[model samples]
Target chain A: MSADLLIELIGVGKSFPKVSRASDRLRALTSLLLGRSPGRVSNVLEGIDLTIHRGQSVGLIGENGAGKSTLLKVITGVYSASTGSVRRLGTIAPLLELGAGFHPEQSGRENLRTNALLLGMSPAELAASEADIIAFADIGDYIDEPVKHYSSGMVVRLGFAVIAALKPDLLITDEVLAVGDESFQKKCVRWMERYLADGGTLVLVSHSMYHIQKLCQHAIWLDRGRIRKQGDVFDVTQDYLAWHEKKSADTGIEHRLTANGEYAVLRFALNGDTGTLPIELPLGEDLLVDVELRGRDDRAPVFGIGFKRVDGTAVYGTGSEFERQPAKRLAHGHFAWRLRFPKPSLLPGTYVITAHALDPEGVRLFDDLPRTVIVRGRTPELGLVRLAHVWEDPT
Target chain B: MNLLISLLAHFVQREIRERFLGTVSGGAWLLIGPLLTLAAYLFVFAEVMKVRLHADAGDSFVVFLALGLWPWFAFSESILRGTTAIRQNAALIGKIALDRQLLVQAAVLSAFLIHGLGFVLVLIVLKLSGYALNLAGLPWVLLGLAGLALTAYGLALALAAAAVFLRDIESVLAQVLMLGMLLTPIFFPPSQIPARFAWFVSFNPLAVWIGCIRGGLLERGLPDASGLVLAGGVAIAALLIGRFVFRRAAPHFEDYL
Candidate 1:
């Protein structure tokens, strides 16, 4: 309610009924009459609190099904909160679902009027701004053609142009930049930079970390419908990245050997052969992954090592198969295995190291270590994956 | 009052644009269905059956037909279209801040406009074939439009509010409109009905409104000034009832939509 804050949300939450293709309308009605809550549906957002001030840009990041879109809808008044309040000091433009107001049968010229009217512009204002809208869209003769004939890219072009021209007080963008080609995406980014320079406020939701780090001063990370962490963009983003890396390293991981299925993995460490930490690795330094596994059965054991990028992209993965290493036969006791990489060639950002143990023939035995380790970048534009290449000139 | 008039103008323009987006045949296409039905009925009664029941009691059969048919068509279409207007534009209701009742008003106004044009064409035909327009009949057109606006507001609000929660109410309204067309005195004067059924025609409000129009154009003057007052009362009552229901139902629109 303060004068400086343009948007304020206090304890806002929302839930949607889960619907499947098999569930028909009649069943939905019958369930409604019975006054029993449906089993499958779950909450999409919960207990969200945030305040956005004038000229501040905030980024929203989350895993899939983490309620990013739902939060944007609540912020823009598309969906009223089930509980709590959302207060705004100025007009809001939810560019949430782009071209949602477009009618296919109408021409682009005519649809501009419809779009402008919905955006609170009167007919006379629309008429006055029509030329500017057309020029910005850059779709010369296509503006007079029916929108149904338009390609999807053309529609986004026109829709984005109209909204950008409006210069609303608060702009809410929800993955709209994911449309169109690479050049259009760059154009949108440039326009956003200009908008920020002009002191306009923005709430952007996207999965691109580079864009998030580039544009946002603050960020909120949502997990299963609640704010998991929020603060300066880099600090929260780094924490979130670290947490996600650790999580991906843990699931479906294998470990080995005890009387019961309760072997605890202890003393997970990655270093060079000389016991140097991963961060101190030289150009061709020996990289060693060391893990200690203890469990019920210890007769046949296999250990595997995999490395992946921050975005969950696998750069390279190697196990006993690729290394030509056989299972370490052992009695019921604690044991350790060391996997070595001749030269760690990962270029940048964040990388994860996961160790799993399986039976001699490759059935999962136990989880050992799922730790994330960062790879220092030697230079910009080196990219995340580094491959050795030899350059030669013809004599 | 000014706000309401401006709202009406906004919706009227929207309706015109949405309904007739392509080529403008002066919206004559909307009359095709009713004219076809009229021709089919004339064929059955005049050419096939050679039936002439109580034709001598009144004026020409077709003029009597025009008086009853046109106004009834307006009301029937208004109710039918108005019932589904909100549901058909769920996006607008779900996303925009425009008045929800405007959707219903647009439906009614568009139907009224089309019917008014049809009425003008029918009058032209009547005059060419030896019928006459009373010079003093201009006031009735104005009165009819006023009554239509009031009555249309009520029907639109009532049906739109109900349709939000009860999904089947739209079809129910359509069927009731069909039944209403038969109950109202559209093709014949109320005097032709028996005394016991007199209340059915008199109490049925559209019967009086249509009777006024028929009296003005065909009878060449006002038809029972008291009847106009009664019609106005009913229209006002419907408007009040519809507005009350609409306000009560407004809060639940977003939840259901």
Candidate 2:
């Protein structure tokens, strides 16, 4: 509870009952009556220990169902934690669900008065600031119209105008920038930048990595209701990208040998290792693909190797025909093909390398093996590949 | 306390204004509902059934009818609206965290104030009709109205909390309010009922508060001190219980919502 720290959560956890079926819900109610926990309690967040200080901006990045919204609700006092304690200092303006506080029956101008008062603004203070909020909102005649008649974008404009004007000590928002047009988003981003410059603390949750890296000083990567990794925005997002890259490549992927088939992929290796599939290779370094296959008849079976990004985005694909080389036979019904890149100028990301054994004609694929490889590099750049360039000085 | 009052005042103004928005007459529309009901009842009971207030008011049934009816309508309408105030403001509740009980109080107090206007007009009409109008009992009648409002607000707090958990309370309250209107001595005086049912009017808080209003303004000046004491006791007790239940149920509001 230091004066410098604005918010702190120690071992905070939240659980929601998983009641899909009516019987399950009924059981949950009965269990409550019986003074016992209901069936199938799923954790949305658990053992979460986080501290946010004044003037610090933190981003929460996670896939859907990763408990990002739930944690925000917990921090904002909307939902009580099921376990542990949370201590928050200073007033919090939680823009968790936009326009949730505005009365639909009231005019946009009238709603401003009520919502501002709810935020602890006095009548005299609200009167003084009303002109600024109305100008920022920029809905000229619609301010007199009831809120229910407002379009969605207009509502966001008004809500954002209120939040921007109040500028409370702690601002907690979820995907507010995702709404509205590009110019409005830009305006919000500029306001947020100024807000941070004025020593306001912010907790932002968004899916856009570009925005996260641009706005946040620190980030927490939440995966399956827990903090998987937390630190600098770029570092945590990189690790999170790699983890999902590996996971998606592994999900529902099975290695199967053809039943009673003549041709089979015996061993596929990346960088001289056959046991483990992943072999970390630096960007622009040589990647060696070694394949050992057993063919019933050796008429120079075709060998193919391809590289694809972890999310199944194809990077490069080539085979023996493309390389103008067929598989060289070593013994009866057994062949070994080796493809080496002296220096592969590929992108820095998670890539899946594939080894395929095809007929000599290469029209139909016979057998293939997939392996995930991490192409690690150090650069503050975006997109698939890094190209070498020189900056020209303009005189 | 002052902040709560200011907040509640703002909310009350919003509630009253928004209820009659886009109308030509503006705030005068707030009087329409209560006045219409009074006119309908005065025609039914006074002209048709030949009833009068205490048999001495002399053809001034409208004033006596209004004095008994308006405050009761205020209490009934306030309690009904207050029961659903929190649920109706779910948008505000879910977004901004504030003292949610203010929603209930604002709903109750606003309805009482607006309907109190119609009751004042009825008193003026009675004074013009040569009935003995004791201007000194004005504060006492206001106190009686305050007691009725407190009693209604306390009930509203409890009902709002219960309605959030069991939505059936809303419809159940509607049915009970229908019974309460018939059971209350609005159309007739308490002396008409049998002796066995004397406790029914004696124990009823609205009955005694209505009596104080009629006595202070129409018949007996200053009202019965015992009835005022009873009204105060009911207000305090209901308020304490209402606070107890509302505080206990406030945290669970998000769960059901």
Candidate 3:
């Protein structure tokens, strides 16, 4: 192992025996005693190959039941892998499930002492930092009171305070920031920023994309106990968010196909592609919508174009009637419209482009068609669309 | 190794504190409880039952019983507490990664420390009251107690691991310990048992330990070489086998727990 590499896991896998039944437990006990794999197991992680080097902050993002906690446990040595190997160097402080080892009957101070010792702090080191921990927690006299009387936030405060004092080589935290109050959250974030600035390695697991992108330079996305993506933080988080957007779009609302409407959309395409596949457009490029509409009578149909995120959030919408520009009449009762957006400043994400054919009065909706468009690029900017801005230096 | 020792000391302190927590008299109960049991047994055997030792015996019946009873309590109590140590700390086992054997060792150590202190106070009272005790044999008696503690620790390790998988071990262990106390020669002298059943006493390891201590303290003599060898063999064997079973079952304790 290189000295710079803090952790290395190659083909690591973990499985738990199905010991719900009495006979199964007995069988498992016998097999374990005989040094064999227990029969009938549920594999939680498989073929995980990863290496975390010194001074690298990596974020772990995954849905619920995606084995994020299990992988952390395996890395922290709380759970040994059922197969393959995991080699780790340097000290690690895992803030998994805050106050997990705290004895409720004991005082907060006493629990801190025990936890610090368990985290490999010597008695002298703990004694030296005891005051710092108490002050950092800032729970007042509650530190002397039994831990059972403490509120949940107080517990988290005490837990984080102890780890902060330890200053371990590698810090692995799992959603620890979601509990504390806003000011305390800011304090912890500031502390973590300083810790990272000091070249400490971190592995953070959180559902909040903002925190992941802020703290981590690299990210790994786990889906169903497997690594779906791993790369630069922006790219992985973008892919993760797009996947969630697509999932919600699949389940959120269904679009109605009005084939027999009076003013139906005969054809709707983005950049001359009339297929169901989503059009991949580069960021900052122009977007063109070609629509061919059919009307029942000799009335011109109004054309409306709109953009929405896959999650049904409207980004931009407009109608030709609002601008007093009518679509060119191709034939009797048939009209065609070509709308152009020159250099749209949309962010990289999945969006749905909808073309609507309304009555000439633009008050009654008649027919609408939706097409998917994916804006592909890499940037650290957030939100749906970018606004023109400039940063002025202090004079 | 230093960390292990430090952790063991912390756990032992915690175990001792937890044992006396919520009690009115707190730590005083450690000595008082055993002393009361001694008083009750003394009243029953020495007064009501009119029990007496052999005519040539140097010590009274109460002394003989006290010498045996205190050591037995230390050994049995340690084993009982050690057997349940893992289950009692299932919360910690599931959360943190530490040496699992430390829990069992701490449980046994705390039990012995408490009972050992009580035993020392009783011996002081007996000696101050002018009862005939071989003060020179006290070191041998201490050595005997240490041997019994090793055996208790070994059994506790194996039993504690097994109890995680088999809950019935806890209940069954209480019954077995009760039966074992009767079979051992704690209440009566070895000479009193019938000739046909003398082999049972010879094979019972606890009997050998109690007899060795009793002989050193009451008879003012060293333990026989054969009994010493047998006791030593049992203690070492129990330790090795117990450690083997414990290590094999420890990693999977989180799953079963």
Give the winner by DockQ. 3
Name the lDDT of candidate 1: 0.70
Over the stretch B144-243, how does candidate 3's per-residue lDDT look in tens digits?
8989999999999999988888888899998899888889877777777788999888877888788768877876434577878988999999999899
> What C-alpha lDDT values do all the predictions have?
0.70, 0.79, 0.87
Model 3 chain A poorest ten-residue lDDT run: A252-261
lDDT of 1 by residue, B1-257 (tens): 44445555666676676677785654666566557766776677557765453633546667767766777777777777787887877876665545677778878987888777787777776778787656376577657666766787797788787676667787688678778877886544566677898877777667767766766676543446676788888899999988877765654455555
Model 1 residue A353 lDDT score: 65
Ranking, lDDT, top scorer first: 3, 2, 1
lDDT of model 1, residue A151: 90
Candidate 3 Cα misplacement greater than 4 A, ranges? A297-300, A329-334, A361-366, A388-395, B48-51, B220-223
Better of 1 and 2 by DockQ: 2
**Model 2 CA lDDT for position A386:** 59
Please give the distance, in angstroms, between residue A233's alpha carbon in candidate 1 and its true position after superposition.
2.3
Model 1 DockQ (Cα-based) = 0.18
Q: Of 1 and 2, which scores higher on TM-score?
A: 2
Can you give the lDDT of residue A112 in candidate 1?
72
Q: Estimate each model's TM-score.
A: 0.74, 0.85, 0.93
Candidate 3: deviation at residue B219, Å? 3.9
lDDT (Cα, tens digit) per residue for candidate 2, span B139-227: 76887798899999999998887776566788889889988987878888776777898888777888878877877776463346686
Candidate 3 residue lDDT tens string, A54-122: 999999999999999989988988888889899989888998788888999888998898888888888
Q: In angstroms, how far off is B72's CA in candidate 1?
A: 2.2
